[model samples]
Target: MYKLNVLDKLSFIFIIIGAINWGLIGLFNLNIVGLVFSEPVNLIGRIVYILIGISGIDMVLFLFKMRKSFKE
Candidate 1:
């Protein structure tokens, strides 16, 4: 089994949120983050999008580390 630290867990959660938001956009054309923070093009909403993107990057980097662990 793989162990995830706090940062990993948080990033995974954010990624999940982003996935769900995308699903909503595909199915209903809704934007959850924009709904929560106001306009999708606004600064706070952009920040949220950036954070989610960073979380995805973090997960990709973590996967490389995890692959090494799996081989050991």
Candidate 2:
């Protein structure tokens, strides 16, 4: 439970940041990854994007488990 709880928190934070970044990209044509890392194709930006994708998958797993618990 401790590990999962910590992971959930971390994943949530990542997801929030990813969502906000996407919103900026969509509404203002801002390239957060590009701006921060000096280029969107940089290794750091790629890693960030990968982690964001993983966090999203983790959040979905969390939600599925939560729903299962509620159904019990």
Candidate 3:
């Protein structure tokens, strides 16, 4: 089994948050991230979005790592 480190855990959390935010947008036309941050453009919001994007990439890498571990 593959163990998740701190970064991996944090990334997973962010990914879940991102997924929930998207779901809300699709189901209820709500943008939680934008609502929490400033509309149009906000530096802090942009940073958060960037972090979420990075978290998604991290998750993809984590999947590959897990797959490799399983094969081993």
Best by lDDT: 3
**TM-score, model 2 to reference:** 0.87
Candidate 1, residues 1-72, lDDT tens digits: the string is 468999899899999999999999999999999899986468988988998999999999899989988999
lDDT of 2 by residue, 4-62 (tens): 68888989999998999999999999978779887636898888889899999999999
Question: Of models 1 and 3, which has the larger TM-score?
Answer: 3
lDDT-sorted candidate list, best first: 3, 1, 2
Candidate 3's residue-wise lDDT over 1-72, tens digit each? 999999999998999989999999999999888999968649988888999999999999999999999999
Scored by TM-score, the top model is 3
The residue pairs that clash in candidate 2, if any, are none
For residue 33, what is the lDDT in candidate 3?
89
TM-score ranking from best candidate downward:
3, 1, 2
Backbone clashes, each candidate? 0, 0, 0
Q: What is the lDDT of residue 32 in candidate 2?
A: 81
What is the C-alpha local distance difference test score of each model? 0.91, 0.86, 0.93
RMSD of each: 1.4, 2.3, 0.9
